[model samples]
Target: MTFTYTVSPKDWLGIAPIVVLVVMALVLMLVDLVLPHAGERSKHTGPANFTVLPAVGLLGVLGAMAAAVTLFFVDHPTSVFNNMLGADAGTLYADLIILAAGGLGILLSPAYLKRLKLVHQGEYYALLLLSMTGMLLMAGALSFLIVFVGLEMFSLALYILCSFIDKRQTSQESGMKYFLLSSFASAFLLYGIALIYAATGHTSFVDVQKFVVAQAHGHAPILLLVGLGLLTVGFAFKVSAVPFQAWTPDVYQGAPAPVTAFMSIGTKVAALLAFMRVFGFALSSVQSSWMPVVWAIAVLTVILGNLMALGQSNVKRLLAYSSIAHGGYLLIGVVVSGAAQQNHIGASAVLFYLTCYLFMNIGAFGVVSLLERIDNTGSDLSDLRGLWYRRPLLAGLLAFFLLSLAGFPPMAGFAAKYYLFYAALVGGHPELLIIGVVASVLGIYYYLRFIATMFMEGREGSHASSTHAAFERIPATPRPTRAPTGSLTRAASSTRGATAVAEKPASTKIAASPLPATAEIEPTHELEGWSWVALGIAALGTLVTGVILPFWLPQLQQAAQSLLK
Candidate 1:
């Protein structure tokens, strides 16, 4: 027996998106080494190239996205690289979603990192790009080996990203917990892969499909059955399904908001796509064996996840549970796609919903990331009270995203859920649709609750302390227009006189304390330029995807046709 090997330019072209990202990650770290003020930046004492590193990362993501889009025009087989990768339309589509998430997540990062005084600029962007590469790899995987490798690659990057804020204990805890639990989940998935290899003597999806179809009884063997169950547990944890979701709220709450923002879409898109490829396509011949278990997880995750989210006061935790529930909604696609009879409706709906979700969900987390101050403060319900009064733009955007997440009409979230539920109904899973709608209704109360807090007349707190709560209660004063030269001279003279007096004596300080040069007023910080870019794109996407979904739906459905066959 011989294991044939060959490398072609076309093979590299098939994985061009991944290759671009890997190159960019290394380039970013190297670029950081040569930037001005590198030593001061590392020590957190001077000006840093806050603009350059994130910009480089964004360009890399854009490049990867371009590579992925180019693959749409290239003719490629279902599997490439010795049957380890997929270059089909579905893989390309999923790659676009993952890249979109990575791009938006990078846009949200620089400001958050700066605000938190996290000065590790180079490694941060590098890991982010590397993480996106892993997601792209997972999206294109056709073999169990590639899937596990991709999972670990992305998961390891995320573990470090989650703990990047050295000043925060919560961040460290989040990273550690994610490392431990994810490793445990990886073990289950890997063991399942090993058992499947033993049973079928293959690891590629094509080979596994052939072996499963060749089985005599139209049923799975006991070993294959156990392996499938373990596979379910592992993927279930990855998707944050119920009974395996305890880590989600904790990790989401503890990690930095931008990291949470990225993982919400990136991790789910990668994990669910792989899950769909494995169960919905590869082992689809044994659909009767795995569908019931996936169906059960979906139902519980949809219902229980919503129930858990109803009481969260912290913005991150609320979104975490929301992410978990949405994961269940996405699983409906997997459950239904197992039936080759309905064509690829489930897979297409998954793709379409993922596109919509990337906008609405990331925008919501982007706002949270933008709002976070020192030590990860300013994300509580109390901090959001009267937010509309303080930052109407942010408040309005949050409402729009929350409404979308709640499946309200006219928002992308509504459109995403509609297509997903339609797929469930069309695929003969009416029960999932019914349960999902009920859970979504439960979800609305929390989203709306947070919205209500933002719109409150004033944040509920006293003015004794100079905290964000009190800051929200204060009416924003209009900044006065610049004065003429003569008036400015007079004002400057008066300010100097007052400062001189305040510095002179303790008795003069009593009268001029607020006017003292050292006395500082808490600034009503403006949204960072990069964050505005992210929010603008997200807002536009949230609106446009819903409005244009009808046009795009058919195109996505055509891409999904490959999976069901």
Candidate 2:
């Protein structure tokens, strides 16, 4: 017997965003093959000459976003490909967020890659789009098999992106660690899926849900409970929830800033949405079996994530922990959504908060990316000291993002949390609300400390006569040739020479006290044009999302209704 599979136009329409991204990635990869390397270009050409690949990538992301918006407007929730994937408001909303993150990441990469002499432009942009496709797939997946496919697709791409900085041992190490740990998580998730399939004789979420309801009315199997536990562990690891979060700080610190920013928001949005779908729908009848476990994880993640972040001096690591804490807050929505009565409130809160987080988190990391120097330097607290005096605009924008992350009033973060906690209270989960509130309060200290360090702290040694004393220590690079013997050049020469000589052996020590009065070190890295654009877009997004909450909230509510439907 011969079998034929019938495909419909609606199925293709359901996946238009993914199709667009994949095509763009392929085109970009091919185009990159023909593009000349930077070294082949004239020395006088600026980095803009190498921006074509990123530009194409940005266009692709924008195109995908447009497609997602169109799909949202269509407002049809359909499972395509034999119920393997869905096209619905929830998936489209996630697509918009993922595409935005991908765009911002692309915008941030050109300058960073150029500064660090990393020139695999084709691979970078292609992998970014490909990763985004995986996230989109995860957001739309309707079955366990599709989820696994999407998970591995993005995970593989991320492993490569994390290791893109070949010169940095830390980057390589991060890649290896993430790969090993994430593979283990994937295995657990897969085994859980397998166990669930064996228990229910189905991998489709709808069939699993039916089986779960039947089992709930009869006798539920212990194997199903075990599968649920394993699934929770897998998702917890992906979302960086407490005990599984040890890799977060190291990976975020070691990866390039743009990659960290993209991963922070993209992975959370994808994993959390999948988590919600799996538990809120497929396993809703058995929630009582897993509710307490999830509750404990959420509580621990919030408390420990905040406390650990307090002592961090590195901006990236601090944000990494902050992300964990945010995951805890999002978990409140997950718990509330699992209850059949409060699903809409919980789901809407999650979508809205993720929207808010996408902007504020990416904006904060954009500032960090702009300031980061070659070899992943310049993210330390000391680098941010007196930042307001140097780059007032950037400092203010960063402060806004930090305040938003801290859930300060009149910002998106505060609005998002208010809805989230209120939903918890309405859902009869007062403990989660209380814990989230207390954690937000404790989290305030670190965010404010960073702001204070930027605006209130003095330069390292401002009272000293030597410029070198006032500025933060510079990284070691080859010394410039001797300048003219004029007073101005004398100070500049002495500054460079001092830095160079300091790196020499003790036997080659130079006199430290005779430097000219004017000797001052300047910040080595300047914000490039693309970085400025990325920052401006991110800041605008944060401001608009916070300030215009009333206008868009209804749309989010509608999307949430569609999600429940």
lDDT of each: 0.81, 0.81
Q: Residue-wise lDDT of candidate 1 within 1-565, one digit each (tens)?
A: 8777997777888888999999999999888877776454454323445678888999999999998888788775556788788888888888888888889988888677665556777888899999988888887888899999999999999999998876678888999999999999999999999998988999988889898998825689989998888888888998999889999988998888888889889999999988998998888888888888999999999999899989899888999999999999999988988873447888888888899999999999999987775545568886687889878999999899999989998889888999899889989989888999988988899999999888865754433223433322323232223645453454344432322111111121212222222212233243278888999999999999988775677666665676523
> Per-residue lDDT for 1-565 in model 2, tens only?
8867798888888899999999999988877765655576332124443577888898899999888888867745477788888887777888899999999999888767765656566788899999999988888888988888999999999999998888678889999999999989999999999888888888988988898887766345888878887888889998999899988999999998999999999999889888988987677777788778888998999899999999999899999999999999998888888873444778888888999999999989988887775446577887778889878998999899999999987888988998899888977899889999999999999999999999999656554313423223433322344434452344345543443122112122332423221121332144368778888888787778788884677666655766733
Candidate 1: global Cα-lDDT? 0.81
For each candidate in turn, the TM-score is 0.88, 0.89
TM-score of 2: 0.89
Q: In model 1, where is the ten-residue run with the lowest total lDDT?
A: 499-508
Clashing pairs in 1: none
Worst 10 residues of 2 by lDDT: 500-509
- The TM-score obtained by model 1 is 0.88
